[model samples]
Target: MKKLDYQYALKPDWQSDARLEKQTTDNQSNIVNLTLSDNTGFAELNPEQYTWLLSFTYQSTHKKKSGSVCVILENNEQNTVNHRQYFEAGETGTRYLNLSGLLADYQTLSQWQLVYDHCLLMPDATLLGFKKPDIHHGPILIIAPHADDAELAAYGVYSDFSDQVWITTINAGQNVQSLDRQYITGLDDNLKDAVSRKAKIRAWNSMTTPLLAGVKFERLSSLGYFNLTKNTFYNASEKQQNDSVCPELTPAISRALNTMTLPNDESNISSGKRLVDDLASLLDQIKPTSVFVTDPEIDPHPKHIMSAHALALAIQQSGHIPDRVFMYVNHLRKIKKFPYGPEHARTALPPWYESTSKFGHYSCYSHQLTLKTQKEKVVSFDSMHDLRSKPRIQKMLKAWWHKKVLKSGYQFYGYHHYFQTHIKANEVFTFVDGKTFSDSLLQKE
Candidate 1:
């Protein structure tokens, strides 16, 4: 295949003036070294207090390749940290190498030794740092617009901080056709019955999956709103009763589907004072120091974007000031087949597009997972009924056709399902301080 160049529309410069430039080389030795001229202020930094990263922009050449690469960094004492990133044939973007595990302090890192496999590294590279997600600051809250989003994007964070983590899923009543397929054959052939059944299963899945991560069962809840129904709640008056999208389901399963009474059982679901009020109430009650929500700027899904907007409104309404907020993207706007390689591979930054913001301004944090934890994530996703159900015939056929005829692998089915795309060696998040998060959303509105 003759590869064509696919480059970012804007210059991928996080810090254009950063030192450490390298000349392009073809099949360069796996190892390279750079010596920092100035070590000022390096000793002042504390490794345990922050997660450090080395970032560089790169342009992939038009050549037939494995589409994956690894970078190994060696400090002055020969302590090394391994980083991996995948780029498509002829793809261009930036890569961030995680440097958190190196034992030496920054001051002792006067010399740099890196081992690279493929692709071209740009002349400029810079170092960045983000505050660690420490539970001692306060409890952590993770917000998901749909049932599986938390597992898909940040399972590692919640798993690691399970002792103090609270997960709340919004819009768990999505009427996906997979639910219909799974139940229609076994139950009375009514669409409403199938949808209702799905609501219960998904709601149950949302409330239970985190248990595997040692998260308290009492700490899990769902808003139970219908798919694409946030707008209805936002537009209606707080007292006005919005009709249930899935009326077949009981009040408990469809509690937040309408603005009437809500669920108060072990599984809490609500839409009181509209959806925003429900979220604000949770914020006020939990008093979380750190929060996680979908990134509105880069995630293309409508519900994901709306969920972030709702969170911003809730923050404004409650006057709760979280120390920090983590934003993740399950759906990058313009790219398809992202995280770009095999399931076992490491995921760096998502490829940037014309509209995507430049990287350096916001703190980028990569939550690296152990092999054991990755297996745990696989189990967590498997518990979600929607992901495990049989694929539609059309989807199966499309995936087969793509693999056999087009030679392009299927991302949503077969080998490349959630097991592949979502289960990566690292989960990357954009770290924005709570004040900045609130201010940015407000400005956008």
Candidate 2:
């Protein structure tokens, strides 16, 4: 397997308008001041229509073994924009920061400063010309590996074009230990009963959250596979001979899987062969113009990657063609506090650790959201039962100390709070046509 830096794979081609190279001495530690050689592009560049990004090639000098490193851009008025991202020790590569929010007009950008708290500039390059992507229309089908995934990754998308959307979740049969503690039967409920209740709650959450986006309940469906079981659905031959042992037979799962009436046989939800077959079946049914799935390679979650693998297998078998396929990264290779900064900040390009010889199999696009739409996205996340914060008073007190006394932001707290990473001013995706997606993504046996 081969891997590539995100920048070369994602960034649009641009002729460098200007360049800078230097280092800060001990007296000038952590700061570099520079003037642009040309400001003519500023007049034509509107932050509304374009994404203004400053690219930096730098090496970190900080001694921290692991965690995110911070880079900041400060204007003449002392206002600053910062991006903190994960980095390996001594790693060197080009990183990007979004300047859209900080930029108002050409007049205000006469002087700017670069601040690297623990990094030293290797070389500087500015890429000035790129337009924000327009929202693609649908008949869109979103594939969710787990119940909360669609809402976490693209609530902004489905919420924006709700009537044109259909959501199909792969895993609604979850056994949440957290739900076990919430005594539904007043102490009579055992593990099996608790798990059934958990499935029902999440199934309801998946069905209803999209309704707020204007997607009718009928447009949503679940495969009802047990949570985190997508990775096991690949061996079609093995599954055809015998039924899987852990089947979701609960009434709640049946209701979630079938829209009009309940299913009689457990085969649909119980069999791995059935899961793959049903996915292809939906492809033929929806005939979606655009489809969204998690990037199998870039997303770190095993179930998420397996979900993409299943989609690839389904497309190969069904031969149904979609106009576009969008792959989004939610976990981002285990980087917890990515899309970093405050929750409301606009997303920039994700960080890259090194340049790659390979480039351009897929292009990156950002789905910019209007403020009204962003608010609606928040409402969708808040509505999901799984996203609700559980009581963690001890963890909270430690976090309070981390933020208040120690003065380090509670950076680790957002690790599991996906809303913090995903509910931003925009969502990003690596995009390819359906044909390329099907041809390129061959599932591993």
Candidate 3:
């Protein structure tokens, strides 16, 4: 008889460690089964002895109810394991083996054996063949309200899954300006022009760099809006000029002057139509298995809402909708008030359960953004501490911490709050196979 150098080490002492009383030779290979005593398990083994070690813990009451086994195979070198095959007990106390077909490759080897430190349960479980793992392949499209919206919303997802992402912005044109000379008296002509141009470039750069790190960035056409000049409306007369305008009017007009502001009705319709066309074209070209878009309900910005509508419409119009479509919310700022409520709570739509609900329900995939904490390092510490002054700073610090943490997950600006209501760390959307769409109608086989 030929001798092999392999050996077994039992853990917790096997109930019975009997070697095979007899070995049979069949098809140029050796076959042997070593019986084991009850309440015995095997210890960990090094790579030199066995190519792989499979361990399982069967239920005490139902011996085969809850146990798992797997083997690690050497890839390039005999002493190093690379690939693995696993078998686990299923819900009904039945054992299922994963990747059992690969065992055929080992059949040609002269020395192969099964070593169980514990007894085999009655009616030994049969091994099932293995199947290949699914591969994720598709273009992840991200739509944002502003130029930097997608970067702020899904940056982490983009970073983690690089080269598989594409981002599009609805409003991409430069802001308009009016002539107000109050603060420009001391500035030189060349300096002022340089300053203005540099500012615009900076804003554009800020939004593009992070996205370019791992995604394809595209700027969509802008909806026409009013312009501002010298901190005032382009058409505003001298009397209306001031260092500080009313709080409400300041932001609205400021954004408009900086970027074109579209007329409510026209911009909405135009943005919607354009988004639909752009998305449809991209879909037809990529034919992605899965698609991700912004949740229409949680999109407060008019542009975001309009863009989502257009995307939904485009998918409906296209003959082939993706196998799965997932929607993420960007502005989770409002989630502080209703952390446990449905996503619709933060949107303009009614709850999904309501009779008048307009927003559709989709699977919610939520994940926490990771953050690193620094150990205490005193640097010019201050002795004064006041309880009254801490609340405001604490609130601000909390918000800042939240933002920092979210970056670790999806690089989105508001993911933490957005994901609170959508409890799943990651949600999956699956389209009914062989389904088609036409005129927004779904055709199922």
TM-score of each: 0.77, 0.74, 0.37
What are the RMSD figures for all models against the true structure? Answer: 5.9, 5.4, 19.1
Question: How far does residue 413 in candidate 3 sit from its true spot (Å)?
Answer: 12
Q: Pick the candidate with the highest TM-score.
A: 1
| Error in Å for residue 96 of model 1 | 3.5
Q: How do the residues 1-445 of candidate 3 rate in per-residue lDDT, one tens digit apiece?
A: 1111211111211122233322455523222443333212222221122211122222222233322222223332221111111122232222211222223333221132332111232223222111111214766555554544544344445555557665544443222232233123334244434334323433444344444454444422222221212122112312222222211111122123222222332322222333455456666655666555555444455555555555555676566566655455555433333222222111111112222113322222222222210000000001101001233566556656655753312121222333333221112121111122122222210
How high is the CA lDDT of each candidate model? 0.64, 0.61, 0.32
Q: Model 1, range 1-445, lDDT digits (tens) per residue? A: 3333322222221221344433236445444443333345455656556665666665565564534445434423321112455666665665555555442665345445554445666656666556566545689999998888999998988999899998888775547464336634667366666777777778788888998999897778777754343354455424333225454443257343232232243333344345677778778888899899998777879888878877877888886978888888888766657776555466765655443453325666678788678778988888887677566687678677766886643334343366667777778877666777777776654
What clash count goes with each model? 0, 0, 20
Lowest summed lDDT across 10 adjacent residues in model 1 is found at 7-16
Q: What C-alpha lDDT, on a 0 to 100 scale, does residue 242 get in candidate 2?
A: 22
Arrange candidates, best TM-score first: 1, 2, 3
